[model samples]
Target: MPDYKKNSISLTGAVGLGTGVMISAGIFALLGQVAELSGSWFPLIFIIGSIVTAFSAYSYVKMSQEYPSAGGIGMFLVKAYGKGTITASAALMMAVSMIINQSLVARTFGTYTLQLFDGAQTEWLVPLLGVGLIVVSFLINISGNTFIQTFTSIASLIKIIGLSTMAIAGIIVADFAFTIPNKASNPPDIGIVSSVAAIALTILAFKGFTTITNSGEEITKPKKNVGRAITISILVSLSVYLLLAWAVSSNLTLSEIIAAKDYALAEAARPAFGDFGVWFTVILAIIATITGIIASVFAVSRMLAMLTEMKLIPHKHFHMPGSIQKHTLVYTVVLAIVLTVSFDLTRIASIGAILYLVMDIMIHWGVFRHLRKKVNANPFIVVSAIVLDLIVLSAFLWVKFQSDIVVVVVAILMITFIFIGEYAFLRKTSD
Candidate 1:
């Protein structure tokens, strides 16, 4: 271990990092898909998703209390499952999912920004901008923790206030009639099953709370503050998501939302306050995505560094300069850039969501079945977390399987390859 400084971030810094990741571009990009499944009640779906997320958060909260480390979930998994392929694979899945998230956010930055331009439908514009952002984030990340914290705190504040203002503005201008402009091909009656299933997708909006746990070692008081940070991040994110969903649902018709699905919030703004509103929402998105990528890269790189120190996964440097953490930062950014360039936005989001929920399921189950007594965690909460994750994950997988089987297969193959590669590496190192 490199003995990095502990307690580097204050309480506000921790919360900022949490919100930086949670209130991400994912919210902007994913609203339409969730609404398609959820119909007119999409805002309520966000509320329901928060309840489901609360259950999943229980395991992480308890684990952080018992074992606070920079390693975060990686450390928790090691405690529950030991230093083996399982821990290594789970951690890598998480790291990769976050990398995918950076790409998702980066691409979102591109999509939203281009909306400000005329004839902005160029083919290569999005990935180019996405890669540019990743490079910028890498530079900012290497500058040190204070800069990262300060910038993220300020950005988080701006994004939250901007989103709130948009919501309120939309509400003030709305006529209170909630109606979908173009009726869907499916029946108008959206049942509870469909709404509950939509929780699988909506969960993505709040999943970034785990980014806070990755900074456990840096928080001023890990045991007390990590939990608080996670709780605050989710609550604030949920509030923002609901407000935006309400604003969009109330202001824009269903067809308008789906029509500008790539940039729904911005499109919704057009009807509410015209071009100025459009620019306002796009600017907020650009800021949100930039901060989101930086926060994610910061946390995931530290996590990979921790995993390397634990020797649960393979690590090598081609005579790189700076610390192991810096090398990990490079690796994280490069991989994210590749995903940004290669995959489309929807595919990247699906891959990330699947990897994340699967990893969450493993974490919850590992704790529930093995470490419940060890950590003094409530078995029921752990169990509920596992069950909720299972239901949501199953719903998500089924939906993807029906809509895009290739993504699900790709995700499964990625997981399998990570496990096999880890096992082989461990065997060789042991020998």
Candidate 2:
């Protein structure tokens, strides 16, 4: 085996990694859907989502500070649950959800790209493009961590500058773009349940911060940089989200937004900066999705490598001579391809959001019950995280149950199967 060199990712590089993993096409596509729920108050709803995510981040930050490892959340679960059925099951759920999320962003990449052309809405094109990007990401990842870090940093820079320009330009043009008061045009009577439901999707937008934790070992100053990277990334994401949401809501009326819900930002760009804005926004969406997929594949493959080392999951050599991370990268891309081809965008996002929230709840509960005192983490924050997750998850389920019952059922089935399979595997290994 060739000795692998240690990755020397700096704090800024770690922050870039986190941002690139997050700032994906989810925000590009879901703004209109969130607007439908929160109406004119989508900006405030984004902030609410950030606050809730912060509560959950508290547990992760505290635990990661005490126990910084490349094992990421899996290590946290083992420490809290003691390597039993519960730890294995929760880790599996989180991993699967992340895999599902890759498919979501992959399809989003295809969706946003097709927006550039007329009659581009073919059923096969989306999955084809998604799988193609996954293959590209796999090749880059196997090249090594240094290459991945350098590529993501550049992608992250372009993404930030593009989005910031769009947001600022939109805000500046909102004054002359439409003289009518947006509030008078549409008054949203969104109740508490609807607001909570909107935050569920918003939470998905911030889920990329968890990707940073997976890179804990690679980051310089693992103890301090890990938490700092997560915090800084979330703040940056929140700022960009709020600014863009305000821009969209300000320039576009409720009807216009809902009409172009599939590609809201691109549509909003048209009115703000005309044809150029449309092209710019679409290009940004493409970049965001591309980098997002690359960063995500990097994190999830590393996570699976960790899982294999712990013997929580089965692995195969496949006659390939490479390190554990290389093999896991192949497996990760293959699974993502399967998911991309099988599910549509809405169903994929539904499964990813539900599974992730469920796993997050388990993480918070584990800490609250077992590791809180040991880690010196605040009990109130842990409890608040649990409560917030439960409320948002319930609201999201209710929304999906009413609109897309099939997706919700599939999510439940997926969760059940993961738990049962992990338990059986662990039992067999013990015997």
Candidate 3:
């Protein structure tokens, strides 16, 4: 049995972990992509995304209140669906989605860091830096929870302050006015479907709250604090995202933001504070992405270890020495590195968004269908989460199919493979 350290994580540290993950590449890397999809009014999507996520969080908060465990979503799934294929597959999907998120943040780290160096060959260096950062995060995580918590807590504080200052300064420089394209000037035609689909990416920005649940077994006052940390993290992220989005829009036009999508934050800085601003933004990005990976890897490995401990997934020592958590840490980093090397940012975010939303829908439905009465959750909120997730997910899929069918296909294949593999494993074990 894995020895989870109870009371090792405090409420503040839990909030650190949550916001640490939320404020990373989610805002720095994805702002422009959301803008591209939603046009000049992209900032509004962050608000809508938060509202949607709040509904989804109701089920998770209720579940955590009832069943706090290191397994997090994995534990929740087993409670709702039992230790069956549905549980295992959905749990695995959540794990994989988190790993996908790590790679996304890692690559974002590379992209933003490279802004400090002009004329550098980025084709290979971006992945190289990303891999290097993931390795460092692995080292930090292995040092134990205390060090990870301290690092994330401090890093989260720095990022929140740095980004907030930058956003506020930029807005002030722009005289608190946004350069929204005039309707008569014929801006990019952003449809309602496109704007709703953009919510998928924005929700990805806030989904880091779920990481708080993964540490429930270690948090002080797991039942009350887990939910509190999640709520606080979401509200904090919403504030930062809104201010930053407005700041970016205030500084740069929609075309410029879309053109510099991958490193939009850095570009947004240039217009407000010149080269110094760009450097500041890059430094903040580096901190945010590094800490983000540390926090994410910390949660993801534990969740996977929990799955292994529950015998929901098969594990191999591979001649590696250490506990199951250590092994899962290695597995998590390797997978993230592979993804960072294989996919570009756009496709990566696409895949993560699709997987996450699908898994989220499963969670809500599970709660509503089986655990609502037991958990004392509102049926309306649970079903509303399901409906909202489905709407955004469908719109996101439609948008992806129209633009990038390959991403849609890859997401579908991944979901199919997970369910099929879990089914085979469970059958073999039962027999």
Best by lDDT: 3
What's the count of clashing pairs in each model shown? 0, 0, 0
For model 1, residues 154-217, the per-residue Cα lDDT tens digits are 9999999999998878877886555444455334645566666678767877888888888888
Superior candidate under lDDT, 1 versus 2: 1
- Order the candidates by lDDT, highest first: 3, 1, 2
TM per candidate comes to 0.96, 0.94, 0.98
lDDT of 3 by residue, 1-431 (tens): 35689899999999999999999999988998998898878988999999999999999999999999988999999999999999999999999999999999999998988899878564888888999999999999999989989999999999999999999999999998876733332245578999999999999999999999999999999999999999999999999999999899888878888889999999999988999999999999999999899999999999999999888998999999989999999999999999999999999999999999999999998998899999999999998999999999999999999999999999999999999999999899889
Clashing pairs in 1: none
How would you encode candidate 2's per-residue C-alpha lDDT over 345-421 as one tens digit per residue?
76787788899999999999999999998889999999999999999999989878977899899999988988898
Model 1 poorest 10 in a row by lDDT = 178-187
- Clashing residue pairs in candidate 2, if any? none
For model 3, name the residue pairs that clash: none
Name the runs in model 3 displaced over 4 angstroms. 181-189
Residue 242 lDDT in model 1?
81
Which scores higher on lDDT, 2 or 3? 3
